[model samples]
Target: MGEAAENLNYDCNYNMFLAKIMLSNLSRPEDRQKAVKWMKKLATCNRSIEEMKLRNDFMYYLVVNIQQGELQPPFTDNPPTSPLPNIANLLPGGIAEVETNEMGEPSSTQQTKKPMLYENSPDGGAFLAAQPVPRCGAFCYLAVVAREPKHD
Candidate 1:
């Protein structure tokens, strides 16, 4: 499995599968790092919507499972040798606006004005009655919240 993951020529999906296995075994930091590297690669590959969701799910879990202090940045501090393509440039009109912090990390403000249907419901809302919210989105949101510097 390790060999297959290291082989650059192997199918990315196959490598991702191997990495996922490695990710589940928390005892091995080296394996976890490798898994994270692949996760980042697969996430940014932009192959398909399904693939992107899968990668985000994996990353969401990773940030949730690992202790905050133990989690390391998957990539190095140095910028990429070649710049990554600006995704906004590919859009027709391009992004209208982006909010960033002093250090340039994206701000977590809600971008859309649309309200949830459940918010408008009266007493018996079916959507509001659903089981606990899905973890993928919540986990990522919580992880970011956890990292925020405490102002007070």
Candidate 2:
């Protein structure tokens, strides 16, 4: 078989191995829930897959369409409101009671710290969960080098 065909077979085997590992690890309830959540997110979220083969002009159109309603438009200034009497305690002491021209609507400044999505995600207990094979490539390469026939 040609080298290209051999490489294609190798890639298929690797992907199948990955799928098996992912499926097996999803047996636990928490893990299964996480997997379901991620699958749903993948299905609904805005995923941008840009193929490098596309021409620049075509890519521009693809990007423009994706961004059609996503961007936020600019904001304009609002009119001022009447001053509140006896509200000096709200401001810091000793400094002049400098008031801003913006409206007196109760502006709520909220700072929310969102929790991490994958803090306890499992180690993906798959075949590759075993020590990562040497970077030079497959296990067969090391086997070949280790079992070289000795010549007298």
Candidate 3:
């Protein structure tokens, strides 16, 4: 379904409906995994996802599907290369520590503190967990994070 969304360039409402249905009916770990893959792919489709507006149902499912992949307790792993400063002000973060070289030194620096929102794994995988569970418990819904709004 995600592939279909990608193929369609997220341009069709019917395709969004189909993808939403597939995501809504997720019942197993593998199913969630697949859904997460689709969501992540959909979120980062080279800014193409920017044009895809979502309804409430689709937004809710997007959050749910991402929450499934998010590691319990939240991500504090390999920080984004250009992470925002003062992340502790954002959420109670966690990290997936990966050794830099064989010395076991943490690769992430203080300035590039990983956002508490998500983690990147050793294999260079990002967003294994759903993100944006803010400190106040408000959600950052995937659609908002997928892309920046165009300036006009």
Candidate 4:
């Protein structure tokens, strides 16, 4: 693969393939390190937009794979309590009051709105009582609905 890549005059695709092989789990640590160096070189030596894009993609994969252990998520297992307002506080009549603009519209900064709730009963149980089993089954109803022409 390295010979083929070299013979191809450092073709982006062939070089990227070689780098992928080197970075694979079965490859030796030295080979993986060499792949990282080669990738960094390719990423910085792009002569065209297409090559730049391909190199950028490979670089992204290399960084994600090689530096995965160093990259910590924004949150931890026992993350500190978020300072942001709670969902309940964002609801209507909650502790936090939404500010309004001069036009009486909710301000852009405080745009929380009451969520739409759908329920067939006050207790919010099943949408409807079970009916007699259809002759064609539930899927037939879906097929029929799908076949209907759009009114618009």
Estimate every model's Cα lDDT from 0 to 1.
0.45, 0.31, 0.42, 0.43
The pairs that clash in candidate 3 are 69-129, 70-129, 70-130, 76-94, 76-95, 77-96
lDDT (0-100) at residue 129 of candidate 2?
39
Per-residue CA lDDT of model 4 for 50-137, tens digit only, reads 4454454444444454434221121111212322223234334544465668886667796444333324344343333343554222
Each model's total of backbone clashes: 0, 0, 6, 0
The best candidate by lDDT is 1
Q: What are the RMSDs of all candidates, in order?
A: 18.7, 22.9, 19.6, 21.3
Please give, for residues 1-152, the per-residue lDDT of candidate 3 as tens digits.
Answer: 46644544534434445555665455556555655554444444343333343322233344544446442221222222331223223233323333354565556554554655443454332553444444224554332335778999
TM-score for each predicted model, relative to the true structure: 0.27, 0.20, 0.21, 0.24
Strongest candidate by TM-score: 1
Off by over 4 Å in 4: 1-28, 69-152
Q: After superposition, how far is residue 72 of candidate 3 from its true place, in Å?
A: 26
lDDT for model 3, please.
Answer: 0.42
Off by over 4 Å in 1: 1-32, 68-152
Per-residue CA lDDT of model 2 for 1-152, tens digit only, reads: 35544444444345334433454443345443433332232223222222111112222222232234221110011111222112133223311344333564333463333334223324333323364666235653121235778999
Q: Which stretches of candidate 3 lie over 4 Å from their true place?
A: 1-14, 47-152
Q: What is candidate 2's local distance difference test score? A: 0.31
Which should have the higher TM-score, number 1 or number 4?
1
Model 1: per-residue Cα lDDT over 1-152, one tens digit each: 24433332234455455546655555666645654664665546444444444444444434444433233333222213342334343323344255666776667774644345545555334645664755224522121224668898
Worst 10 residues of 2 by lDDT: 71-80
